[model samples]
Target: MKPNEKQVNIELTCTEIGGLWGIFIQESMNIRFLTYFMHHLQDEEIKPLTKVALEISEGRLDKIKQIFIKENFPVPRGFAEDDVNLSAPPLFHDIFSLSYIYMMNRLAMINFSYTASNNVRLDVLDFFTECIHTSTEMFGKVVKMMLSKGIYDRPPKMEYPKEIEFVQKGSFLTGIVGKKRPLNAIELSEIFFNIERNYFSVLVMLGFAQVIKDKKLKNHVIRGKTLSEQQIKFFNNLMMEEDLLGTVPVGMEVTDSTSSPFSDKLIFSMINVLNSVDISLISHAMSVSMRTDLTAQYSKIIAEVMLYSKDTFDIVVEKKWLEQPPLVTNRKKLLNSD
Candidate 1:
C-alpha cells in the first residue's frame, strides 16, 4: 500500500444526494416530533428518550445541511416553526409519545442502514453511519424505557423448533387452494409489523381528522383513516383465518380535545413520509411471501397505497407546500436560452 494509492474523496453521487434529501426531510420532521414530545412528555424516564431523539435529529440536520451547501444543492424546506404549536395542550398520552418515538427510531435505524450502504462519499458515509449508531441507541433506550413502564407490546410469540429441516413439500408455494401452508417467520413478522404501523396510522389520521378545520383536508384525513382500517382488516383477517390472535390496535389512546397541536402542513408531511415507508415495507413483505394469495394481497395493497401517496404529493404540490430538493439544471432549457 503506497501513500499515493489512498482513496480519493469524491463529490457526492446522485444516490447520495437523493438519499440525503429524503433523510434530511425525515430528520427535520423528527426534530419537530421530538420538540412536541419534549414539551408534553411527563414521565422522567420518557423525557430522556425524547432528549436523545432531539439531540440526534438536531445534530444530523446540521451535517446534512452542510453537505447540501458544500455540493451547491438546495436544502429541502422541511418542517419548521409553523409546523408545531408547543403552547397547545398535550394531544396524546405520555405512553403513546414513548411508543411513537420507539417506532420512529426503529424506522430511522433502518433508513440510515440503507443510506450508509449506498453512500460512496466519505463524509456522506460518515454522516449516515453516525445516524445509524444514534438511532440504535435511541431505540434501545426507548425499548428499555417502554418495558420498564409496562407499555412495551412485544411481538407475537412462536413455538421453538428443536431441529432444522429442508422443505420438500410443493404446498409451500401455493396458497390459493386447500390446505395452505402455515406462515413462516418472515411472512408473519412482515404481516405483524405492517399491522402495527396501520394501527398507529389510524390513531394519527383520526386525531388529525378530528382537529383539522379545512373541509378538503379533513376529507383527506378521513380517507386515510378509512384506508388504514381496511388495510388492518385485510392483514388481521389473514391471521384470524389461521386461528391466531388477530392484530390489536393500541387502543386509540388520544385526548378528547379537538384542538390541533400541529399545523395541517405538519400533519400532511408526516403522513406523506410514513406512507412512503409503507410502500417500501409492503414491497419487502411481497418479496418474502411465497404464498400466491399473500403475494397478490401485498401487490394489490401496494398499488392502492402508492396511489394514495401520489395523491398526497399532489395536494402538497397544489398548495405549494412541497419542498424542492436538489436537482441538476434543465439542460434542454439551458440549450434554448437566448
Candidate 2:
C-alpha cells in the first residue's frame, strides 16, 4: 500500500473476501439441512441433487477454513453434527425439501454474483464463481423437477402491450392519493417475486414454531410467524388490488407432527438466514419501485424488520449460538498492557 513496500505472492486476507457473512451463514445452514435431507429423503429423483449441493457446501467450507487458518483468523464455529438429528422423523415433505433447495440456491446465485463482483482476491473470486455455477445447476434441476410435478407457482400473466410506449405522465409515480396507475410489468414481477419469497419464510417459521422445543425459541419462532404473516399480507394486498393471485404458502404441506427434528441452534440460525435476506429483498424492492407510496411501504417494513432482526441476533448471542466474523487485532490493548 506504500511506495517503499514491495509485496509478492498475495494471499487473501479476511477483508479482501466479499460477502463472507453470506457465504459463512448460508453454507453452514446448507450443511445442516442437506445432511438432514440426505438422511430422510426417499425420493429417487431429488436425492442426487441434494448430494451435489452438500458436496459443494462441504468443499467450500473446507476452503474457507483453510483461508482463515492461513490468515490466523478464528474459523467460525458454524453449525455442525450437533445442530441436527437425522434419526428424527422427516419434518418436511420431500416436495418441500426440493422446493427449499430450489429457492435457497436461487438466493445463493444472487449472492454469489455480488460476492464475486466485489472480491479482488483471485481465490475468493474463483470460489464464488464456482458457487454461481453450482447453484445454477442445482436450481435448474429442482425447477425441472418441480415443473414436472406441476406445482411450480408461476407469476401472474398479462397480455402483451399492443405497442411499445413511454411513460406519458408524472402520475405514474403517485400512489398516495387518487387513482394510481396499474402496476407495471417490472413492478408486478418484483412484488410477485417478493411475496413468493415471504411465502417461504411464512411456512418455514410455521414449521419451526411447531417443532422447536425450547420455550424461548418457540415463542420467538411463533412471533416470527406473525411477522412473516404481516409481510405476506402487505405483499398480497398489493397483488390482490390488481386482481392478481397471491402466493399459496406451503404451510399446509407440513404434517401435524410434533417432533423435534432439528436443534434450537439450527432453527435460530435458519431464522437468521431469513432475517438477513428479508432486509436485502426489501432494499431491492425500494430501489426498483416507481411509485412513491410503494417505496414508502418498503421503507417502513425495512425499519420494522431491522429491529426484529436485532432481536433475533440477540437470541443467538444470549445462547452463544453466533460465531464471530473475522476481525482485526486489538493492537492498542496489547501495547497498553506491555
> Which numbered prediction scores highest in TM-score against the true structure?
1
Estimate, for each residue in 99-177, the C-alpha lDDT of model 1 and write its tens digit: 6787888888888898789987666777788888888987888888878876666776778878997889888889888
Candidate 2 lDDT over residue span 1-338, tens digit each: 67644342486655454366558767888889889889988889878878887998988888788766876756777777987887778778877777688889989888888778787766666777888998898888888888887768888899899998998889989999777888888888888888888778877887888888778888988887888788889888888888886777533557666787888888888888889888998899889889987998999989988888999999999998887765667999989994
- The C-alpha local distance difference test score for the whole of candidate 2 amounts to 0.81
Model 2 lDDT, residue 314, Cα? 96
Q: Could you tally the backbone clashes for each prediction?
A: 0, 0
Model 2 TM:
0.91
> After superposing candidate 2, which stretches have Cα over 4 Å from the reference?
1-8, 18-22, 70-73, 331-338
| TM-score of each model, in listed order | 0.93, 0.91
Best by lDDT: 1
Compared with the true structure, all predictions reach lDDT values of: 0.83, 0.81
Q: Model 1: residues >4 Å from true position, as ranges?
A: 1-9
